[model samples]
Target chain A: MVTYPGLPGPIICDYLSREASRGRYGPGVEFQIGKIEMVANTGTYLDSPFHRYAGGKDLSALPLDSLANLDTVVIRIGGGSVRAIPRAAFQDVPVQGRAVLVHTGWDAHWRTERYLSGNPFLTADAAEYLVSQDVRLVGIDSVNIDDIDDPARPVHSTLLGADVPIVEHMCRLNLLPDRDVRFFAVPAKVAGFGTWPVRAFGVVST
Target chain B: MVTYPGLPGPIICDYLSREASRGRYGPGVEFQIGKIEMVANTGTYLDSPFHRYAGGKDLSALPLDSLANLDTVVIRIGGGSVRAIPRAAFQDVPVQGRAVLVHTGWDAHWRTERYLSGNPFLTADAAEYLVSQDVRLVGIDSVNIDDIDDPARPVHSTLLGADVPIVEHMCRLNLLPDRDVRFFAVPAKVAGFGTWPVRAFGVVST
Candidate 1:
């Protein structure tokens, strides 16, 4: 659902035949192979420490505890008056060792021009607070965690520099409850790479 | 770890600066954006039902019960003499409502020329047995689940056609015990797509 204004959309091309065709491989075997060409930041993606620091851990080195089956807390910011999320927003929530997901309701505008303009973002103080709280991961249902117009990207610097992974361009946060949920956002264990797209989701206990 | 003899490898490119560089964005902002391009079958991947059947469920429609946090069992086939796995292999193992992972020790040759030649595969009877057992998912540590020379792809046809997902080209099964493990192999929820790469893993209860 991501539509970065200037970035290339995901490209899916067929390599093998889907229908029965006369080919060198044979006719009865209708295998469909697909080639995907897209930016790692194309869709809902996770950013490892290497995404910001050259010497930091990449996606492959990320520990499973930090990416899988984590306690989660969802914060609703869509109905709030402020766009710049502050430390006060998380003051009452237990964030330590949890995936703190900020539901901004911006994903409703995904794939539209409005999604690219003036989306909600975390303030530097909020990022610094989360880092100090030892949060395992942070996710937002918005285009970027930091303001796109801000050149410094203080949020990315503070969080990623502290080895906390970030998940952006997420959707369906509303489908999850406020607490007692397990979150997962595991990325491909690709070596020498910083950021990669992920299948991010929250597992609600039935 | 997947080397599709003639297919292109993953491409990782920089979209932003890693260090302080004099660019249009700014010098102080040290961000590294990455662009990835590869075939969906580039590495360890999951196959949805649509991969084999046009009218089947795609990646987006796959239920989480079939992909995440299911009880798992690993079967070691490396010590066996036959490359074609038989139904007798699972006679003593409990496979219903579980992820049946076959460990062939072939991943030792990953990224090598020998990894692609004459790999082990499941026989048609084994596939039928798994389907009848109502296994949640199947994973293999070899190049493919079906013999590459077989044009009909009976294993894939039998499994995927029955809505049984398959994970291929996996590694590190040796790190997991034979049982008491939870397996996950989730693909991106892309609509209309049949298959995609995944970050497959097994979770052990400590």
Candidate 2:
């Protein structure tokens, strides 16, 4: 449970321990039911429109196609020190109606002190570029898609404003190629809940 | 959030409310980061082997193939009055190597007083039958997949003992056909946790 530095990490506990369940089940049959308490932004999580706007769609309102089984495009930001990703990087690729994954390789710093400061983030101009291209969803391997120093979080506002879902804190972007990838990061379909963690994965079809 | 009876429902609050975020972000730009606290067996949740066996695989150890893009086989329990789903209902279906979703029409009682008792469940023999056939996963559109009166809970024991995951409290099974459906109900990749909610859906291939 990799929560942001200021927020609380996930607390996982056993509601019905296997040892305690022996009284409920047979001698050889026992089950352990767990309980979790955490903020929705912990670890790899997706944001629906409702995260940014009150009148926007929540997790239950999102259609399945918007979150699953779509052609993907990965944008690589090399040099390892580029903190502010600009719009120039997204100039001319077939990004319309695709899931764009920004591979910053910043995930190497996950759970470390290095991840807390001067992390890579997408600029507002880049977000404007993506919304202009009608991207279905945008994801990143970094902790927050927006620059924490900037108060507005323009990337999240711009993307979620156009009904484009965002997935943050993704891992294994290097495992994905530049093309022919299909990404999935569906949140639990709970009404009034706008953000939650997901088991984000991508499949490359050769 | 549809938690089981006698348990608390999900509490969804804002960790970062849109009203509060105005101080952080610019005017007209605000984000709402939600927080949730609930038992792992809430609505449409999946159980890993660790839910039943302490040494068994938890959510982090589950391979994606076990939860995604699985060829599905829906076994319809018609007549709307069958309380106990037997192995005979699963016979004559191409269930091997596929996700088996048992439709007992019990979801119609969801969120109602009727959903608490006398609901549908799979017999222990039915669980053994599917495990013998090497079923990849088993799901039910019911609150509990085992007879609550039966203290042993043999179905959960047998199926989870064989490393076959289970999905419960699923809805909308009546909308699915008998075959050519691909079911996906992936849990969050969390270590030390054995159960969690999922946005379960099916893609019917034409």
**What would the per-residue lDDT of candidate 2 be over residues A1-206, giving only the tens digit for each residue?**
45576778988888778888788777788788888889888889899999889999999999999999978999999977999999988887788879899999988999898887787999999999999998999999887899877777899889999999999888889998899998889998888878888999886776
Question: What is the DockQ score, from 0 to 1, of model 1?
Answer: 0.64
Which residue window of length 10 is worst by lDDT in model 2 chain B? Answer: B1-10
Model 2 clashing residue pairs (backbone): none
User: What local lDDT does model 2 show for residue B52?
Assistant: 87
Worst 10 residues of 1 chain B by lDDT: B19-28
Candidate 2 on B1-206: residue-level lDDT in tens? 45687667888888888888788777788878888888888888999999889899999999999999899999999977999999899889999888999998888888888888888999999999999999999999887899877888888888889999999999989889989998899999889989889989888877
True contacts kept of each: 0.67, 0.91
Candidate 1 lDDT tens digits, A33-146: 666777667788899998778888999899988998989999999573457999998989999878899999998888888889788999999999999899999999888899
Could you say which candidate leads in DockQ?
2
Off by over 4 Å in 2: none
